[model samples]
Target: MSTPPPALATPLSGPRFQQTSADLYAQMRRTHGPVAPVLLDADVPAWLVLGYREVQYVVSNPEIFGRDSRRWNAWDRVPPDWPLLPLLAYQPTMMFAEGAEHRRRAAALDEALGAVDQFELGARAQQVADRLVDAFAGRGEADLITEYADGIPLPVVARMIGVPDAETADLVSDVYRTHAAGEGANEAYARVRDKVRRMVESKRRAPGPDVTSRLLAHPAALADEEITEDLLHLMNAGQLPTAYWIGNTLRLMLTDDRFAMTLAGGRRSVGQALNEVLWEDTPTQNFPGRFAVHDLRLGGRQIRQGDLLILGLAAANQDPLVRPVPQASTGNQAYLSFSHGEHRCPYAAQEIAKVIAEAAIEVLLDRLPDVGLAVPAGTLAWRPSPLFRGLAALPVRFTPAW
Candidate 1:
């Protein structure tokens, strides 16, 4: 059996270890100087890669770095006899799977998502946004994050995945809160697992054209257990990160007048503006946790087998080595926020950008030209989770065009 690496000592007394998400990122860059290595959570035995190249190297090179969460101490922190462990058990989702398995899952999701019409999705997004805004527009003061940003993406995912409209809101809320706070993680997991199992069983009785049905039809040579795991993976894929990115993007646009104006023009500039927002405010600041499968050398550091590796996506995205070229025709390459490797967030960023951009054009900017934050910029409360950066609420008021 491979031995675990030494535990990380507690962080030094400095502003770097502060709880502020933005500050923690800044300190990582300053102290690590691009490729410098830091440890996370004193007891977690992980190395943080803060440079652009280093992060890319670690993430993309699956042979050296792996996403087998089973190797990490995360589960160990929980009790071995805990029922939650089984529910929280890491499944071989696209994000955790490597090689052929990952490719297969990606292809399935891509095919399903590809079937969606961009224009139609945009229209749907606008309708959702309009209804949300209409509910609160009359109130004058509204929390954009809770009322709009958090509410919009769930139905979009539900519609795509073929969940009934009536159940989408509750499921989405449960999954979002569970994933974000690690609160009710087990309960949320169990709830979704049971739901998917029933859905799959029902589909067996009578299947439809939904994404889940499509996956069930192929099964891709996977077992029933694997199918259940994949379904849970899909549930997570559609919830937490989308909530984070949408909320973060809206916050950015509200804070910067130029960005808001640019997006108001229409979908033509929406993509570029969204890219800027992602670069400026990464949704997932820390790298998705990975475990070293074998002895590996990365950025002049020797990583032995069993070492925990944390690729700092937010830090790498801002690395001066990969300078952001706003005019780059290729979109946002400098930003490693979604990662760039075997376990990268697989078109998630792109999808969210499209939704947010389309909504900004069709809803916010065009319909509420004078809409903006009622409070000053810095007063907005950001979510305090270490994994994702997002606003808790964005209280804003605007003049209705109607």
Candidate 2:
């Protein structure tokens, strides 16, 4: 009585996510209207929800459009070397779990993250940003992605996780493979997980004032594996997107004369600039997928059970239904940059990422007022992947302050 799963057409994610530009998103919305059929991988079909209302609906009704991918029919047919397995594979953490398990796991994260002092967290961000700028302050040219943006999150997150700075620095190489989709990805994935395992073991042996220690002490009393998975979720969830978000904002601040003038003239705050960037070019363009639970009609499309549904947040943010906001940090949290619904990112309220980004850019520009792109804007190369939207490098030249 039910319709069979849809056949593959073209990948909805993958290289197209690299097309996070406003024009591309507009095209998707215009062509697909709200819901459009696109393959998740080459042969993996899924519906991409581009409407703001539709994304909210799908994410809010997790009971119907669930988080568990193991329930997906395609999971059984896929081979072990599935290139996208690292992303789509089921994990026991809140990221992929359903019902009561999601609550317990999410609680551990919420509590630990809630305990962080915003002032201190912002200070730590400033310190890290300053140090990174110092490394290249003497040179007139620096690749902001490698020297600044790409360098920010891991060490700060490592400290928050109780991972030593040295180890965090070493992870610079491995994190690349973990975020990318291709060869050596599995190996890079192993190294990062093993490192997290070591961190979990270290935290268990000697409790520290970090997220790991806090999770261990929480009422949930997560096991080592659960703690590791949750941390991995945080790493996968936060690391690259946050890094790229910072980079993208900086690019806008440095390149767009109108935006540059406003922020420089004090007409707009750094937070405001960030908010505009979120609305215009959301850091995480797509929210990977939410699989359907049963045969359901949504946005005039027939989606069968276990079919993946990707929410085009970048496109959705600009959806005609979504109006512009007056302030960046105001009560209007409608933007999908932090995602929406019950599964919304806990850090949406933190403002820690904004501080890190603002501080990093301000420090670099303060020392070198003339900083700008080392190459033409069009020449900037981006890492093409469905999971993240980011520049491969942001090469900039500046007047050496030192």
Best by TM-score: 2
Candidate 2 Cα RMSD (Å): 3.0
Off by over 4 Å in 1: 1-20, 33-42, 73-89, 219-224, 260-269, 324-331, 400-402
The sequence of per-residue lDDT tens digits that candidate 2 reaches over residues 185-284 is: 7777778888998999989999998888998999887999999988887776656777888888878777777566754343245666667778777777
* Residue lDDT tens for model 1, 124-170: 67788888878877666778788877877767766666677887777
In order, how many clashes per candidate? 0, 0
Q: Please identify model 2 stretches exceeding 4 Å from their true place.
A: 1-8, 13-21, 76-79, 262-268, 323-332, 348-350
Best by lDDT: 2
Cα-based lDDT at residue 268, candidate 1:
55
TM per candidate: 0.84, 0.91
Predictions in order: lDDT: 0.64, 0.75
